[model samples]
Target: MSTVAVPELAVVSSPWSLGPLHLSNRVVMGSMHTGLEVQDDGGAGMAAFYRERAAGGAACIITGGIAVSDEARGGPDFAVFGVGGADERFRAAVDAVHDEGSTILAQLFHAGRYALAAGMVDRHGAPQRVVAPSALPWAAARGVVPTELTAAEVERTIEDFAAAARSARDTGFDGVEIMASEGYLINQFQSPLTNLRDDEWGGSPERRRRFTVAVVEAVRAAVPDLAVTIRLSGADLMPGSSTDDEVDALVHDLLPLGLDGISVGIGWHESRTPTVQAAVPHGAWLAYASRIARVVRASDHPEVRVIASNRMTDLRDGEAVLADGLLDAVALARPFLADPAIVDRSLAGSFDLVNTCIGCNQACLDRSIIGAPVSCLVNPRAAREVAFPARPTTDPKRVDVVGGGPAGLAAAVDAARRGHHVTLWEASDRLGGQFDLAALVPGKEDYAATVRAARAELADRGATVHLGHPATVADLAGSDAVVVATGVVPRAVDVPGADLPHVLSYEQALRDGVPAGTVAIIGGGGIGVDTAAFLTESPDEARRATEFGARWDVDVAETVVGDVPQRLPAAHRTLRPGPDVTVLRRSGKFGQGVGITSRWVALGRLRDAGVRMVGGVQEYLRIEPGVLWIRDEHGDEVGVPADSVVVCAGQEPALPTGDEADGRPTDGLVTGLQAAGVPVAVVGGARDARSVDAVRATSEALEAVRRLAP
Candidate 1:
């Protein structure tokens, strides 16, 4: 076996050195929801998940927040550390981490008032009162209120943190990170927005710091060898909450407690601060880290280390912060999800191949909300490192991959990594297919970057990336296997006047440009809605509409047959961010297809932007020049004026070759691969490819069996 050289990664020689215990590397994988704890084997899957990260070179891995007690747990799916007392299963979790040559840390946390009261009501078969520092409604979900915690209850909470730390040490963990950020229970006690207690745990800044300090002291006493990392909300960044000066004072006071390190994080649960956005530069929260670091560094106490987190993606930026003495180490969350071997890639100087997490917050947090395992849009093996470790193929057969979207790139890369000589053919000049257009959208540059990174990685890994080639059977001849990733195309509507010169498809516009003029978009799906929002000009409007550019009252066309199309569930829809735009409904009914939550937000944006509504229209035709003829509900045609007609209508799979074998749509590249008798797998948005991963794995497994046949 050849040793891979990784340079960019900060080597941690000891876990205790960083915190209470020495660490091996500076890379700390952030906590994420894996949904693996709920596996039938009782955290067996979860153990494997952590083991992979540890094997990948994480010195210390922090498991997703666990409930100190039952009431604090989000659900049965959440990993419980100390609930029902620490047991053998918990020890198994710790052993799993240690067995991989890395230390494990458990986050001690409580939801307090933020606990899901409704969820608890359903689970317990009765309603339960939500507890917090004060009787404040959960800001995100209104009408669900929490009762204030008493002074005694506050003391108990501190004890809970200490007990959790003891559990960590007992369970063989390196240490515990006190949950004091993101407006959790500890955060509620620290923030004035949630904590309105009049006693020693609330009301005054000194009192608020009391609970945090006590938790630190108790945990330190409980596990003197275990590193105790404090995740602090340096600046709540919320109105009427703890200010920067108060945070500074709090950290300074805690510095003498012999803490291991302080991971400075900003933003509270109810914060209006934009944590992830293009407007905010990378490593935007370095200032907050620097502030706390300054306090700890300047203090007489010498044990505590300062760790910088929050939007730290680039190595140069992280090094800059470390070089500037702002932080001792950098904690990366989403970036790790994108590439677990980020340290290796950085050390290899393959920054181009390192998937730059665009802060999309899509596969990471968004998927977590739906109870799906956290995943990465760019790196396919991110969370599946153990389940799908890179292995050499037994057959060493040739493989061909068609299309170059995320799924295709992943399949090709995996196949190549398995020691197969692979050919990746893209019909277009570039590798990324439909995703190429996605990169043009504002704030979506990450999508493009991910595509570029995948392409570069494939190239470096020795996959033949053949641009400007459409895969065909003749071209794929004799290939052991073929992987098809032919992506989806725009959905079209059969409405009249669809062929006008001004009527432009979203793909065409992205490939070309949406000329600066009046424009109307037909669909209100994510693409359509996003297109409509992007066409408008002006920053305020873009923010309001959440579109690409600043909001400008540009000439735009929006097709409404008086009714909105369905498929736009408010839960999944992204509302246009600005005004200076209009929506024309085909009928009087608005948001017929949009989801309730998304509809409210989108329609609210449209109404706020002064979008014009055109209803009860029929027989949309080209009437005169520069106008669309629309017949009313009564069959009366009227001319609606417009400068450009933009089509955001849906799409269908446009097969490059009309090859229907045996009276069926040929399974395309996937079919071709199987026919070629090569092992293959598919992934990503292509539903057909989901099953391919299993097939490829099984095929490789069978090949191994054959190779060993006597």
Candidate 2:
């Protein structure tokens, strides 16, 4: 790649001006459940997380859900903001973020009936009934019944919110956003389904909205200058639940509570939507945001600005929402993971290459549930800021990168930060190869974000980019050393239909849309199963009519429309693209190829989608025209008819021939120059030291680099 001048940036523009606080930019970091703080000093860990983002360039930071009271905590390990009272530690946390130059806020929450009190047994191991508006069993853990909050208990709980808010102000936090969304305590009180009470706090929409109002009024009165925000789930994505009209009514009712703004959020933790928020486009949750804006504007609450979130990842999308007046500002979570300097990049006008959130719920939501420290799937530096900050090394080292995928990108960025002049080469124009296809899968967009962030880091680090250029012994011409990150190649299978014309690989299928025909995918691994799902029809039923077009034959739709439910089912199903695709298990069943944890989740989606799964590859035959041979569950050989055949078996590395290796690419004049001696190092999937083949190849490369090293 040729050198290009990066435009200068103006640091003056900002996105929010709430009360006495003037935020530098519209990019707000949403609350993330950091498991690090859940265990030890909540104050220290919480402060570090916020300080990292603040230092990295977030205009405003919202700390993860801090419980208002122990009884209202969603889990035992969660941070308790209400416990410390108006203490010195709390003040220090607020001061920490302020010192980093960004305004910070604490999200005061009460999980209510959602709290797993049983898990929080005392030292002697006894169960407890956490208080709630009504005596209700936890939806997730049905046997656990929560105690109904008496009139006094309810009053005390409201006081907890007030106290937490007062403490947040005293601690020097710029603001506080009340957590009322995602079916938490405030949400439970807001919804009639959870609050089946006869008192003034239940039965009607006005009554249901009372608890939230009381907390807001208390918080606002306690901290006059602090930007008081409220986060609400406009649509819970639950069936037979409160309608949008009811939610709007609740918002209007709370508009008079003197809130600085209402931050709109969508979806529950267990929501089926790949992108949690509803009414949002692929990358932008404009619909849900627009609704929130409409509700607030319709109320004519001049003091309350609507801050929109839910799938708003890139600055371009944030700018669009701001331009359309749908929202005053946009809040994000995963984008910061991909690139901590999101705001700086946006200001520089390189928003097109901005690393964004691909909606992978792994490090954030998954780890939080498992009680593990929440980190980014792509950006490994998320929770390691204080301990392993990404800073340049004292002295520079000449480095060479072998692959151009996630791991390679990570290594390259880390090396560049160490002040290395790096050269990263890919034989193709595309930098993200397999990752590009991975992102095409539903909810796997974060893979692309990882790739984008890698490229940005490389550029910022001054790493030399060489595309469509293969490295040879001659290319190793000059350099202190090299690190081979050569990624893995596809694992080819020797099957009867392997050489068939229609038998396309997973990469090929993503590059080209799955045709409307009888599609049969071979292999039951993560890649194979996911490939099958993609080849089938989409699980989104609302778009089925227009999305199918002329391809909507009754048989085709039925075959493609597997068992994945449109709503969150009693049993969750793995979400995959379904457009008349079938799976033929060669050895193991579905999800065998993916990672264990991810496989279990994917298996659920597949089962829910009602996919026709066949085990064992022994019943196989040949790809004779439109027919495929497979054995049924009864161990009988069956002939399945298909219009197209696809192979998603996986990948391998592409190495040069012996002639090219010997510096004698005399086959073509051009091939000779392509063999320019270059020090190449490979990494990623195939680089696992345990694998004999990978070990040998790696050893050979290390030896070669050693010979060339000066």
Give the 10-residue window scoring lowest on summed lDDT in candidate 1. Answer: 555-564
What lDDT tens digits, residue by residue, belong to model 1 across residues 157-219?
Answer: 778777777777777777788888878777777777777778878778899888888888988
lDDT of each: 0.62, 0.64
TM-score of 2: 0.79
Over 105-154, each residue of candidate 2 has an lDDT whose tens digit, in order, gives 88998877777665585324565457678887665655777788887888
For residue 449, model 2's alpha carbon misses the true position, in angstroms, by 5.4
**Measured by TM-score, how close is model 1 to the native structure?**
0.80
Query: Can you give the lDDT of residue 220 in candidate 1?
Result: 87
